[model samples]
Target: MAGEVRAQGAVKSGQLDFPRPLTTVDVVIFSILDDKLQVLLVQRPAGEGEPFPLSLALPGGFVDIARDRDLAACAARKLKEKTGVTSPYLEQLGSWGSASRDPRGWSATHAYFALILADASTLTSDARWLPIRDGKLREKLAFDHGEILASAIQRLRNKVEYTSLPAYLMPAEFTLPDLQRVYEIVLDRPLEKSAFRTRILSADMIEPVAKMRRGPNRPAQLYRLKKNSEPVYFVRTFNPPE
Candidate 1:
């Protein structure tokens, strides 16, 4: 019962003994670096005689009802406390509850997925951002976390194909190439630059700004999502690389 949650107050014997399954939250936070996708993981401390002295898993913990007003607040608090990451694009992925998902007791988790800019400087020493390749992660994560992560990855891949959700991963102003890189990273495929440009432009999800990003080479024109551009659904699903 390592991560089990107890009731706040004692239950009366004659009262209706309602089963209150322990509620918790888990976050799968993703970031992009060098056109590659990465996910943040926190190290779980080793207990005496455990086979794995240390293991990695998504940043999460039991929900503190007194401190957290809701499930999302608990997730955000745990993410910041465990990984020092805050203020990213977060969305509920799904609920996970199985008879044997947790070793402790009956538990239900409201899992979330977050998209953030890759910045190692913002993370704690115990937190790491690992690459996502071959449609999977390299580390042997703890508990049912691997399944949760895979679910989040699939959700992101599906969403990016139809929705303008990926814009949350970029800066306030970015070039088309930059946006394409975000897509390529999330989808794990090299996009046809011209075709990608045409598709994105035709959708009119973004608008050109009167700004340019200066670099060693020529300045690149900047663009941002239109303030009132509605998300387009039912588009063609993007194909992943073989």
Candidate 2:
């Protein structure tokens, strides 16, 4: 009799449950390429009844409950599937959902942003990097992705002011000048060299490698991010060079 009561309770709850929303995970992958901060976008497959046929969109897909253990897993899986690259820095941005966001049905999406080296992986033809000029995109994106991308750019720029985020966009080994160039590209301003060097060194996020990068003028010391190093948060934001 107790088993029957439990089954009846389950049925009652099931009947009361509202319709589930369409769930998906999307990732914004950023890299430095061509002296600009670029984002990877994939072309949506053209298909009959496709919502955004032949349009570019952020890499993402519906969550696979059987395969994805959680949102982050789903995000990493989608990132690899779309870009053929895995990022060293990935963070949850925010969630977006609405009845009007998707034409198929009520939909909700979990968004994540990631930083990667441009040369880390070869991108498939469907995926390509587009330059983000002035923290904005020129082309329209599919499925409300334009708004999502804008939010990601804002988040990344805001975090870069005080965090060691630009480090993830660097190659395995680089010089201090190389690292500073990346910071300027992302922040869209030049930082005081002495001040920037002091701040970065004091953070203890990177260590000098034995090797050096030979350049035209002279050899510069190469440094790599410390193993298992997390982003170092500075107490103050970077100020533009006077």
Candidate 1's TM-score reads: 0.83
Cα RMSD (Å) per model?
3.8, 5.6
- CA lDDT of every candidate: 0.79, 0.88
Cα shift from native, residue 198, model 1 (Å)? 3.2
lDDT of 1 by residue, 1-242 (tens): 32233353235774644456667899998888666788889888788754234789888878898999998888888777755667767789998987577765577889998887765337878888889998799888887889999999999887887676777778778999899888877876777888778778888778899989899999988998787645556466555433
Give the clashing pairs for model 1: none
* Per-model TM-score versus the true fold: 0.83, 0.91
- Cα misplacement distance, residue 202 of candidate 1 (Å): 4.0
